[model samples]
Target: MKQHPLLLLVTLTCIPAWSLQADAVNGGIALIPLPDSSIAPEVWYHGQRVLVTGHDGHWQAAVGIPLSQSAGDDYLNITGSSNKIPFTISHRDYPEQHIFLNNTHQVNPSPDELSRIHGELKQELDDFAVFDGTVDPHALNLTKLPVKSNQVLSAFGLKRFFNGEPRAPHSGLDLKAAEGEPVTAPASGRVLMTRQLFFNGNTIMLDEGQGLISMYCHLSQISVHEGQLIQAGDLLGYVGHTGRATGPHLHWSVSLNGVRVDPRLLLTPALNASLLPH
Candidate 1:
């Protein structure tokens, strides 16, 4: 087929538009091409410091993107500099049934009671909201799974739809375990908060140095308390559906600085201990 002059001109014009569209679907995975000396030595996401690596004249960061981050386009604002890079997130559709709870327990609280419970829960979250301060990214301590069971009832970063209305994304990984199952700490940290909330029931929040913390919710009992320093393998509580739930399970979550990151990211193959909050 003979290429017409008009057709060739139009194709050239469309090339830039096509490239822009391609970038939109590719997510925000890219190397920072700026020289390491030109870039600020640190970057953070949701208050948790990111681990940036420089190699071969390129800068890379192992950014811990939060599960609560909404899907679609996102951006990372380089502090102290005007560098802003765009990133895209492909939509992740989670089935609606996973988050719903069925009424079964006679001990279940009424609507008014549940509201009171929520109020208490809010207070606990407020206590864990302290993430300010410069941090060394590699200072955070990380470890392997404390338990051998891998059966997950719900995953982190799930977009929740409650009763056909969109709700906040689930912030933790839910593991189904028998009532009264042992709940162990994933790493060494200080107990920041322990309380019975409306949604989380018996909750334990552990601060692993710096601003990094881990939370365990819906427990049958809390064994730790505020200002208490705990070591790895310490019993924080017993797994049970204390808060709102369809069944007994443990909700395991990690908050870097203050941003909730993937719990699995803190674990290693041997389940050995590592990572000290900077």
Candidate 2:
């Protein structure tokens, strides 16, 4: 089936005259212009820190609208600023996907397994809450692809059903990586957390400056340790079918300000123009 790009309409009203840059689509980013390069204002959206970047004496904050966000008015708050930025969010429909699982245990875990899963989920949430404000804000640019393949086995934001039972939406991009294939960091960042889980398996979460973070999951091996600093294209791990996966592949996810956006959005032309230098 052909994949369609999800669309969202955002309207900004009663805000400062700072130019509204970047697309305002669902799973997309919106760049809110800042007062000056020196003013690193604290911006918040959906109770999470907004990723900020500065260039050429101008500063802008990037806010990622989640795919599940309904069409309506949304607001961003800048601490100590009197004016509130109001923007509209539009609707985007994702396609449904069905997968049959041979492992019935994964589909319906035992009581002990459920307890373990809950603990792992809490750890992941804590990791995602981290935001390192020390790194260069301009380092938010994702310079490389995590895996070597251009083929995508599955797109992001698809509603998935396992063995005729509906499950959570697909939250990340699935790349076509062979078993034991090397996975690398797409951007420079510090390792935040690494752990194996029932759903994600061996996972490495990297904090790429500000509120930009990336995760590589279902790995056969992890080469980096927690708190380790990694450069772009640095080896993170090897791909595998370690978790609930049916086959060997890489599940890569990108989070902005704690909101899970499409990983491919970072590769889009619109983001490259605004986030990357010419």
Candidate 3:
């Protein structure tokens, strides 16, 4: 087919952008260059931090990743820029492990009850995804954990299966803690969502502004509420196996620009330094 001159030019122009759609940066890692004020959030690899910088007329942000977050296909859909760009993320795979939830707790419901429980859990998670909040990402400084309890029981990005049926990849870190354990905010953020979920039990969602959000699940009780602005080390709630848990623990997750990334990546020195009081 004979292509028109304009069509050929347009096709050539899109080649580079199209190629980028399949590119993957590590989790928490992004090379954001906002030449214009219109670029939206981008997705980096699933387990690495990405660095982004604004140059010339562009603004950028980079993210470095830690050993959390499951690897898989991810995308960055940007908007409101002079140019709209969507980046593709290719996640590298890490080793996988499984723990037998084989021993059922006496509190476990019967099979019919479990089915009902699953439905309720889905509803709660959906609520977090559709939460309404002001899109802000810079009003607060990301901070370090106030205490030193950083042991990880379940790392992010591991593919999960329930009862031999493949399930969604795990999106958060599961830290072992005793019931009634204190949970604190790692940084300053606004409480955007707080609810009792079927699977999460007591839950909290914090908005760190600019489309960054954090989720804390399976709490025994929630201490914050929607629209409440909280500071670093602020009390969020107590740990428990509230939702669809096999035991008592805390499931912590982080989402950047709406993409679920490994929360541990944000704890690194580079990201942490950027969050300190200047």
User: By TM-score, who's the top model here?
Assistant: 2
Which ranges of candidate 3 are over 4 A from the true structure? 1-23, 26-28, 36-58, 61-88, 102-143, 146-148, 270-278
Give one digit per residue, the lDDT tens place, for model 3 in 1-278: 89987775444333221101111444444544444443323423332222233344344544333334345543333333244334444556744544455534324567886787778667544533432333434322334542235556777777776655555667777776788888998877789788876556788988775446788998988899898999778999898898678888789887654466666556644544433220
Which residue window of length 10 is worst by lDDT in model 3?
14-23
- Model 1 regions more than 4 Å off: 1-62, 66-91, 98-128, 132-143, 159-167, 269-278
Q: Who wins the lDDT comparison? A: 2
After TM-score superposition, what is the CA distance of residue 251 in candidate 3 from its true location, in Å? Answer: 0.6
TM-score of 2: 0.85
What is the TM-score ranking, best to worst? 2, 3, 1
lDDT of 2 by residue, 1-278 (tens): 64432311111121132232355667767776766524467888988888766544455678888877878888888888877888877777888989999999898899999999889978876777677888853334454578887677888888999999998888888988899999998878899888888999999999988878889999999999999999888999999988899999999888888877877767635433433211
**Distance from true location, Cα of 138 in model 1, Å:** 7.8
lDDT of 2: 0.78
Q: How many residue pairs clash in each candidate?
A: 11, 1, 46
Model 3, position 98, has a per-residue lDDT of 49
lDDT of 3 at 155: 74
Off by over 4 Å in 2: 1-22, 35-37, 137-140, 268-278
- Give each model a TM-score: 0.64, 0.85, 0.64
Question: What tens-digit string does per-residue lDDT give for candidate 1 at 86-108?
Answer: 66555444444334445433245
